[model samples]
Target: MRGRSRGSGSFPPAINTKAWFIAAILAIGFSDSRSAMSIWKSAHGGVFSMAIRANGEFFQPPVQPICAQPTMWLAALSHPIVCLVRKLELLVALLVFVMAACFFIEMSIVKPPSKEVIRGLFVPSLSGPGATGDTIALLGALVMPHNLFLHSALVLSRNTPSSVKGIKDACRFFLFESGIALFVALTINICIVSVSGIICKNSAVVYGVALLACGTSSTITGTYAGQYVMQGFLDINVKQWLRNLMTRSIAIVPSLVVAIIGGSSGAGRLIIMASMILSFELPFALIPLLKFSSSSNKMGENKNSIYIIGFSWILGFIVIGINIYFLSSKLVGWILHNSLPIYANVLICIIVVPLMLLYISAVIYLTFRKDTVKFASRGELQMILSFELPFALIPLLKFSSSSNKMGENKNSIYIIGFSWILGFIVIGINIYFLSSKLVGWILHNSLPIYANVLICIIVVPLMLLYISAVIYLTFRKDTVKFASRGELQMILSFELPFALIPLLKFSSSSNKMGENKNSIYIIGFSWILGFIVIGINIYFLSSKLVGWILHNSLPIYANVLICIIVVPLMLLYISAVIYLTFRKDTVKFASRGELQMILSFELPFALIPLLKFSSSSNKMGENKNSIYIIGFSWILGFIVIGINIYFLSSKLVGWILHNSLPIYANVLICIIVVPLMLLYISAVIYLTFRKDTVKFASRGELQVPETDKSKVANDSDNVEHKDQLV
Candidate 1:
């Protein structure tokens, strides 16, 4: 027999993915060593005076520049920017922290040969008010979108044999690589947190002292990572080389200038600015990935399991819900502080009334509406977008949970289940917070009769909407259709690239995503979001838009009625803008100018999908949605559409009525009759037109395509033996 060739037969072992991971971890340690050494050298003297040891370590004691007493003039001049930059650095740091947590949780499931370690990592204290919340938040943040892409691409770097032994070896190597990366990530996070916790704990540390040492440096690291990720994804190799130098220069030059001029204040300002940037930019990368991963067509059999989907949703809702809570709380607190009288508060109740209606409408849409909005554009978008400060971690839940994207190496069932439970607990906490707030608001302002009526009006519709939605989802089938992992991944791949385009064109046009890296939809959505933000900013700056219109709109308080009508619309617009712009991938937005354009584009196509999928006479066979289900879904969907149309039409009608009959603007008859009329007609039309599109086949047996051999067992022998046994 020919001697076994090393290439085909395999030597004991050659190069492995684990080595790369190990190398990366080592690289991190080396970088940390350099950082520490630099700090030490500055303590002894300047960097120029430092010398290296024979063992490749710095001999000088690293020290921060702040230790050297600066001139009063320089300190005064530099403190502002330093404060800003340090704050920005913290935001980036927090974002990265969240990403690391999510990644580790996801990785732990498919990780190799580290069962004891994995168990230790996941063990969380279950006893505190925030223990469950923090864990869920940590997990949500860690399952980052780019990290998912990074892992998928990382695995592709090595070629393995197409045999079982080869696969086993490959898995082992991949795990090691992943483990090393995770460790390094954890180290960086711990260092930052340790530094923050230590400094924050010390009252003597003060603002400038705590920031001077680590502020710009931390931001520099994050900027480097962001730039690296963006450039790497776009395949722009040369840009990375240039960006590495440019980014470091940008960070260091600013710090050096600030040190020379305003000292700590200047550096502080830069850090603060950086923090705000990161906080605001987060939602753009989060929402798209959620929509994508939860999508059945994208994940196929590997799509988010029902439990995971339900859990992640609750978590997302809670996060969004908190923001809403804060908004309401702050508003109420402000009203109380101003000492507004009881009558004014009743006027406030009038505004609150319509908002309750809109809120109910939104809840109904989310719960009962077929998950047909392949891309969310309104309240859901706002909900996801509001979570920008949390960073790309939200999408990680969607990506990591999908087995199709990760192949056989998806998160374990236990992990998915736990993640979901954690998500719900967080939502429950937020609900409690919001409910208590509403109760406080009612008690503080309105009479008992008014309060009870307010509660009934708001609570009844909201409960109905939420129950309807839950009931709908509970009954829907959970099957996804897809072919290959590559195809599945591609469906959601637009998220990363779309995230980059906005940061480029709108953020800094010079830093375009580079090449054919973005789609038309991405560009459109980014601009739309940008404009909406600008609009909101403008409104805030103008007294008439925010303060006057909101606080003093009606005469006896006609402003109150106006606020009730406008606030929800404003919120809806804001939410739509947010969803469109912040998605991981780019989506289309109809400009105020293009409102007609988008409606025309979206309406027909949207209805087409609903019509085809819901129709019983169509192609689904016995797998069709039942007649009852289809009828209910159609009624619900059409009603939702009708509401959208009615909101538009009624608002337009109200505008005409107000302008034409200015004296009658405060008339309750006008408000009640106009809105009620639109609602009645829309409801009637929706009910009449309802029909079931998806239905079971008369033949009874639904056709299914061939799937994984693991999924369905072959029973040819049993089929043949039945006759023999008979």
Candidate 2:
């Protein structure tokens, strides 16, 4: 046989090395020659051109081949790599199965789960004290933030047909694939939990070994997830190694710290904490996914069916509700049981409670707030992921429901009705969760008579406030519409006396309101109306107070004490009203700016007393003013007070500079005013930081009758009485 000869003086070993590397990479990525050829051609500018011929001879044309493959040995070596690459998912799945089998074998050799384990896996029960937390952890682990993104992306990666029937078939196949995978995972998890329960001592090592394998394998998946998320949201490409390195680096620091400080137990606790975090983050991922899948705009003809959308939302809300319950229970327990001093507790409550309220508000906003940025680009998906995860779902729901957007794909009436029912269920769950916690706290705490009295007083008012809030949320037309124009005018008419007296007094006094004030006729009418209103208010206050005092049975000395105190206060109040009504204006017609400046200074005087009373636990009980009401009230109060102080200081400084006051006089004024200001500030701070002292009676506690000792008995009757009281 004639042997083909190489034209070159020597075959470059570098060429062989390069060829081998190229062949190996191709083999790792593609199993079939068709795929390999396509990729190779793309890389080599149109053809899989090689420097050497099939017979180990150089081409006669002297044209430089895109790639140099000098021999067949390198190409043949890549075949096994190709096969491995093609079966990568299958290989991983097999490895997992093997590890699971090994764990099962270990369990059989040692201690194994009882038959009851199977029942436990299927039937949910929170038997023990830690069961709730354990259930939450399981939920968190089952529905992880990374896993949510991973699963969706994995499903989308399948090569499916564009036609309706083909698409349906593809979906069915994928669903089957997902169901099988999840079943396997669930089985493995159940086995692990059971095994751990059986052999609590040595199971740590065994579980750890298995977990290490699982985690190590998941690193590749995690890397891919990160890559997909980054590309989807940011439209950026990163090298696999670099992406893996970044994620590993971030995770390693925390792991190292926990390992160093807490060791293995701490590491385990860290896992629990991570699960909780994932639970909290679940809503952010879930809402968007449900929204997008249901939305006809995003999914087109292949949008999620009505039943699927309804089921998904209901499930999502259930998860969210559980997370919220877990959070609130833990927080309240911590607050109640903390070893901090009462004052410190009060301070923290004042700060942290408002923050918690804000957090809740933010969650609500995320749920309902419309998306401003339309996710039109791949990079914008990241924006949705970051800021508007919950809101991203809103558009989906909107589009899916709207005939204009979805056309034939719009949700049907049955689907809509079911969705609304699910929505109602979510709302009901939230209310029940909150109310149940409140009721439990009330029933659990054994309190003194005084505290019980306070609780009773507070509870009624709080219930009213709660009802008001619900009514406002349900029926209020617009957020900014506090009152209708007619309602406002009627309110002003009712409150006219309180405003009119001051206005008329200032206008006529000439020292406050401008010189060109109200005309005599207007002044006369204003004074008459103001004085009449004042008389009615004074009469009402006196009658109510006196009647209350007289009707109650009291000692002669006590009655005397009440009258002595009340008579003087009534006189002073009457005298003040008279003086305000008669006072004359000092200045000419004051401009609108001057009026505003005056009102700004006066606002704090009204607000401070109002807030002091409203936020007072003595007056409002444990269900005191809501955090928003209290915060907004205090903020407005402070701003007004600050303005008044600034104006007062500026005027005092100006008077001292221009009026030729002695140094001593100025110092004396400062001494008096500064102390008063300091006292005012101190009073506000004290009020703000004061803790509610009212406590409610516990489940079995009953108030004892003062008169009849024979009738009072601590028995089932007492329990019945307690129930009646609640």
Candidate 3:
């Protein structure tokens, strides 16, 4: 009985044996084929030859070695392994198709399970760590940002049920369908991990070569598929083609370089970097979600349950808190080390000080920013574009839970409650994992060995406790009350509309968020709150950049370093502010020429957000922002642009000023307060001319849209008649 409970008898012999056989065959084949394939491929033309030939290209040039001779054997071995992976990938593709079909079946034929089964699914259990983690990730991934938009639109794919019972049933079916698809995906992931861990453990050379080939091939395949799919769906042509080529090149170059330089070390660094990046990226999604989901004004009576709103807030905070810690620790460490020259340090402080004040002011605005008693049309449009569109939840959660839209089926109460809890728990785990690394990095640098060890001992248990909480939430079985259509839509209405604003406002070309979005203000507040948390990181990055510059043996190199490190950063902030101030409403595309230019410049930047939002796959749905957000997000886009430009310009400017050809320095006002002067004038204009668009009210008060549509309906008819007469 004890052994059975321990899962000794839980394994079905049929599946167990099949799994082992598969693993064994994969392992055997991997070792045998590697050496032969590497030798053959290298002697011929290496992997590229095979790729080009596969594409029906005539191979011409004497095949050149793609890898060093030493690495050639390893590369050749990767070929058959590549074939195996491709075959397995095809199988996975087939599985995805099957899953899609099952989803359709659930939607069209099978009835949703009873509430009892729903309860069984939601309540946490020891079930197995593998199962538990898979379930959590499956659910997490299912809530994709794009799907929010897609699901909302897709629910309109067919006539929806209006009856409450019918709607409830449909919701149940949608949830069931999604659940099954997620489960299958989880199974595939587990299988891959299990297989790979067993097969590739000892052969570092084989592992590296195979992984690189697999990753590159998969990327290329995906790109080809994506381009082909887009071409089929849209009428984009050669000019856009060039744009795509450029964008792909820019994105791929850095990644490729990183891979080459870091090798396997790069992969680990990339993972850590990605985690921090994700943490930073979360707020961009979370704040908008929390604001939109919780708003009574946007959603009306269908607003999120207090419990949901509260839980989401806590989860968002935890994630944000962790990210802030990582950021701050790095910063503080830099400060303590004083890696930069005294002059350079002063320059940075001078630049950062005002911006810090501005950031604080912006936070005050966010905390106190009142929604207008009436909705402004332009603002509404902007808010929707900026906030609602980016997060992907507005449409997804609405349609998924809507009884009127779905009918006699919605996520059972257990599913709804458990899903939210599960999402939070997953987020919490990520936070814990990241926070531990950040803390460990800081202590290792600063603390005595014994003290650091003691700290780890204390911190480790707290982390475990956090993990336990997540586990508890996962296994807690309870029945869930399905939300009504109104409730679901309310969540959508509020979230989708409001979510757009922060992204839009912050990114806006115009400083419409006023002083709210300035880098200084934002950075300052983040720095202050995040000091103890991210001090180490800030310190580390700054120190590295500075130390590299100062310690160079060559005077020319040191000068170049200062130029690279110091000047560009300052210019980036200045440029960000300038870009924001000068931003225009390029919303309306008057011509195809106009559209192409906009897409070319904008699409690359837009890819960043899209990659982030969609990477998780399940976090968003169709509601994910369209390429249109790129046009609108030009304002916030300045942050990245400013950083790049400033980094470049500062050094160049300093160099030019310092090493002048005598003529330019005399001609230009090197010490003039031109930017400050311009800023003062602009501030005056903003203060004098800025419209008070926002109006705060008591909670539950409704805002009216700018124009009553019914009133304009007759006027539109009259205009049409007049046009006909003319």
For lDDT, the strongest prediction is 2
Off by over 4 Å in 2: 1-88, 110-113, 200-208, 346-359, 369-726
Error of 3 at 97 (Å): 11
Q: Candidate 3 deviates by what RMSD?
A: 34.8
Task: For each candidate in the order shown, give its overall lDDT on alpha carbons.
Answer: 0.44, 0.56, 0.43
lDDT comparison, 2 vs 3, better candidate: 2
Q: Write the per-residue lDDT of candidate 2 for residues 1-726, one digit (tens) a residue.
A: 000001011113443233223222221211111112212222222222332122222122222222222111223322334433335466558657864874676477456546677678678787977677777766666555555555666655455667887777777776787788778778777766776544333333443345433543344444555555555443457765565455544544444444446533554566666555656666655665666566665466788899998898888878878877877787788879999888987887798778767656645654665533332667657543433222333344455666655668899988877865654465455456556766787777888768867876887587557546644443444323236567777556545666777666667654454567677898889777776777777777788888988788898799899889988987887777666655554546667888898777556556766776777666666757888998998887777777777777788778877877788998898898878767766665665566657655643355555555445554567876543322
The number of clashing residue pairs in each candidate reads: 72, 16, 109
lDDT of 3 by residue, 1-726 (tens): 011111112224452343223222221222112222222232233334343122222123333223223222323322333444346345435535543443333223323344533465466443643343343323323332222222232333334466655555555565575577557655434333333223222322332333334233322322222232222223223232343344344434443344455543453344334323333433432444355445666545545688978897777666555445544554555666887888887787677656655544533443344543333467668644442221343245445665655676776777767766655654555665558676868556866888778877887797677556645544544345568777787555433323433344454333244334447665456435433333343454467766876786778866786778776874564455445434665554245665665564444345444444543223444554566664565445445445544544575567766774686563465455446445544553444344445444533345444475665787899996544322
Q: Per TM-score, what order, best first?
A: 2, 3, 1
Whole-structure CA lDDT of model 3: 0.43
Model 3 spans with C-alpha error above 4 angstroms? 1-247, 260-264, 300-302, 346-726
Q: After TM-score superposition, what is the CA distance of residue 504 in candidate 2 from its true location, in Å?
A: 99
lDDT of 2: 0.56
